[model samples]
Target: MQATRTEEKTAETHGGASSPQPQQRLRDKKVGDLIAGKKRLVEVPYTASLADTINTLVANRIMAVAVAAPPGQWIGAGGSMILESDKQTGAVRKHYIGMVTMLDVLAHIAGNDVAPAVEGGGGGGGELERKMQVPVSTIIGHCLESLSLWTLNYNTSILDCMEVFSKGIHRALVPVDGHLENVGGVELMESASSYHMVTQMDLIKFLKVHEAELRGILTRRVRELGGLTDIVFGVTDKTNVIDAIKCMNSASLHAVPIVESTDEIGDDHGQLVNGKDRKLVGTFSATDLRGCPISQLQSCLHMNIVDFLEKLLDTPQQEACGLRTSTREHITCQPESLLREVVDKAINSHVHRVWVVDGRGLLAGLVSLADIIRMMRVWMLSEPA
Candidate 1:
């Protein structure tokens, strides 16, 4: 028979030993100690066609690819021979000139004046149909200059990597030697990679797996977590559709939260959107720009954001976006919510950043998967060595 409470109490009275606690492995793990299975190098050549670039991105399930061009050249990519290290400092030159994403490709085509209308379809034949013919060099213009791409190296610590991810930035590039060298006198040569990719998604996956084993994780609220620095750039619902898009492009943002605007918004920079009782209403993403009417593409710039979203929601599949009409409410979280809950919400919703609101439901800030991971690193660092 199982011991009764009386017996257990007696044992405790007699000074019975407490059960041993489980050992922690997550605290010791470093980004440099990234799981052997995940550290892979995938890149495309500068000369690769736009069609091939899309195919490569789809095949690898990656969002962006590095452009490999020669040193002193303006462009570079993943696995390109252009990246080389300074022998004295072992730092690779910033030959990494550009990164191309599907969103960038899609946005460029949709915004292109030359993009012809499809006879029966709402937009061009398809999003990438006509643009695929163009070379990447021509199609992907000014992206490298626009995107504030962060850098990483093979030896980057998980704690340090967390700093970059803490921002809403989704990806980072790791520069390698791009030369084959013997590994500790081994016969075979290993390629010194020019570039590799690390994403916020990767960091989130790492945390979810070990969530159960971590102590005080669920008990702690996000309000207490540190290093959350996703710079929340917002747009008023009254802002011009084109102007909102420009804000996103200039900041290289994936999504801009929509807050209530007090005044009429347009290209006029004098319009200052004062946030008083206003709060986040919705969001607009690059995905929203896909499948827009090719004819109305130019006019959409002047269309009010609220009007755009209403029109978009009415026929998203056939019109200005992919955001589902069914998903009218954007996913959000409270600052007082548990950290563990935030992680679960992000994973389940598959959202990169969760909007953090205050008690009155005002937009306080945001927490990304990177922010959570950064906190985990902080927690790890806080543990006894």
Candidate 2:
């Protein structure tokens, strides 16, 4: 029930003594300071139309767009697991509010389940379709109820924020000055409203810059981090771009790996002997969609994903298709690789996730920037940043 507990606790504990200026005694500095540097929180009102939501996210190319899920209307995600009902009585678990992503917009546009139908069943499906084009607030009450919202205090440490993200929550909101902006159902403070969004990407950038200072954590192996998992989402190169986007949209992913087939994850393509299948070759992202003829993008949900990637890659074959210009490439690392190595590769390449390959060079899991920063087991690292 206490969504803003962290902020409230900090204010109560640091009352009067809390300086507006950064805390100097920590020597290394706190995550709170890092968050303070971010300048705005990108948000859309709960009343915003689905098209508006897509524009807000795609235009900003951000991980999350805040929905105005204010206190009472939404619960904050990822804090102490046992901090409920007082362990004095025994811990009571609670489900945190969920967050929204581009997937929501894409799904709505494509007619995918955005969460069970809001309100009562419609007498006429046509009327419901007509209503969807109207303001989102008509159905936002139900929509926000189903979302995961993470709330943290500006004073929360980097370590804690990492834990919050590690729990599978993509983004978070930190309460600053009390003047609130009613962004849909979510509330925001006026101080620096837009910068309130805290994503794993932001945290990764921080780690990259402080790599040396944080070597103890960075030196750990990727495989040792429990967060690393297999390439769970992918598709054959033949799947059309539209279907691929649907998959990505449903899973709320930025990109999906392109492979030969769902054939078990081994590089032993030699078994096919006379077969002409390509190996685990290239991957594509939503960003790649930008390279396609601008018009195609607006209508590309049903287009071939291969054609889209090809258009972006602009291969000799694609050039024959009238593609005049373009750009792109791939990057990956091994499970045994150190976090620092993955960190360097991702930073240098300006990519989001590094494919984790097996000893046989087969695709395994990915070391995503979000997953990298969210690997909180490293919090126990011996060295201090």
The positional error of residue 232 in candidate 2, measured at the CA in angstroms, is: 3.0
Top lDDT: which candidate number? Answer: 1
lDDT tens digits, residues 1-385, model 1? 3657656776686577344335647654555444335645566666777767766664554566766544565533322333545656756553544577756765565354333344465454453455565666564444433244445555555556666576455676554532322111111112233445667877777767877655566569887775344356677766766566556655566666777654443424313233323477876765554435443554454567767767766553432222332225766778778887788877775566788776776677788776777677667677776
Q: Candidate 2 regions off by >4 Å? A: 1-28, 69-99, 112-146, 178-195, 224-227, 249-252, 262-278, 286-295, 312-328, 348-351, 358-361, 374-385
Give all candidates' CA lDDT scores. 0.58, 0.52
lDDT of 2 by residue, 74-175 (tens): 333322111112234433322223345544444444454222232365333443345346554333323221254545556555666666666565566665
What is the alpha-carbon RMSD of candidate 2 to the true structure? 12.6
**Runs in model 1 with CA error above 4 Å?**
1-24, 30-44, 47-62, 69-97, 102-134, 138-156, 167-169, 173-196, 226-232, 263-277, 290-327
lDDT of 2 at 84: 18
Candidate of highest TM-score: 1
